[model samples]
Target: MKFSRFAILYVSFSLAVALLALGLQHFLETVPVLSPHFWLLFAVIFLLTGLAYGLSDIGIRKGGQVSILSLMGGLFLKLLISLVVIAVLIIKFPENKLLTAINFFSLYFLFTLFEVICLLRNLRDQNQT
Candidate 1:
């Protein structure tokens, strides 16, 4: 499926970024929490973003009347879900709230960037055809 290709690309990109961040952190001897948990969190975020984008693409391709509402709604839902998950994680680990929030925002921004780019590209293609 198209989502599978997108997922693979996103996963690779996310993983590479995470690795680079962790390596830099280690080399500079800064943060200590760039652990497996951080890696897994971003990986899941990437997957979720890709899945949402794929669904949006499918809807646009299938529904002749698809509108900007679809794009906005998808983004809203994804942001809501991500925020809720982050809230729960923060609540469960209050001691590391700052780090958790930073990591969450970083992942959120990265995924959002990818999501918006894909949506725009798809919209452009649709408009062309």
Candidate 2:
């Protein structure tokens, strides 16, 4: 479960989820299209989460206080970016505010889950070695 492998997995999984959502949106109107900017939100979530996890993995591999600092910094950076993106969307698309918020939060939760799982795997590997 190296960081590189996990990153790739995250990207692939994100894409699959996006496709599934798109397909579902066709059948169920409530599925949330993320309209006006269809795939942008998905891309952002994947990229940001992958970047954060990859950087955290690098820091953890180095070992020491750096690991804790990088982990916290990565989490903070991710949260900041998500908030900023959501806020910008809110301002830009006032009419679709609810749909936009729901889409962003859903992606955030999914990516966060991916991040935590990868980090936990890193931690277990570190403990074993």
Candidate 3:
């Protein structure tokens, strides 16, 4: 029943991002035509997600019984995957500046996935080897 430091950090970052995004959402709503609270909220989420996942991946890859370089590579792959998802979404549902919302969510999901996959792969490699 011991908790991992990475897990604690991830949860803390997620909550902090949520709170910050909520505050920013309020601020965005107060603006004029540039008011895009939804997009702003998502932008914060994506940025935080990338930071948390990338750092976590780096730590695990470096000594989790797997190749550390792969962990570093996962960050780029995750970014690419996020961009592709955003592109596909934009093509499927054309929106104005609000498109940032989709991009944010896509990146968040992709980054989180990359972190998880890296950890799992490391575990698998360790067990197999």
The clash numbers for all candidates, in the given order, read 0, 0, 0
Across 7-115, the per-residue lDDT of candidate 3 in tens digits comes to: 5655665667566756755688754322234454446545655564555455554565434655556566656655575566556656554645543664366447645
Ranking by lDDT, best first?
Answer: 2, 1, 3
**Would you give me the overall lDDT of model 1?**
0.72
What's the lDDT for residue 69 in model 1? 55
Write model 1 residue lDDT over 79-106, tens digit each, in one string: 8888887787777767767777777788
Candidate 3 global Cα RMSD: 8.2
Q: On lDDT, who's better, 1 or 3?
A: 1
The 10 consecutive residues of candidate 1 with the worst lDDT sum are 31-40
List pairs with backbone clashes in candidate 3: none
Identify the leading candidate in terms of TM-score. 2
Please give the lDDT score at residue 38 for candidate 1: 70
lDDT score, candidate 1, position 85: 77
**TM-score between model 3 and native:** 0.50
lDDT of each residue in 1-129, candidate 2, tens digit only: 775688578868887888887787887876556665446887787778878987788889988999998898888899899889888878987877877888788888988887988898888989998
Clashing pairs in 1: none
Once fitted onto the true fold, the runs of candidate 3 whose alpha carbons sit more than 4 angstroms away are 1-3, 32-66, 97-129
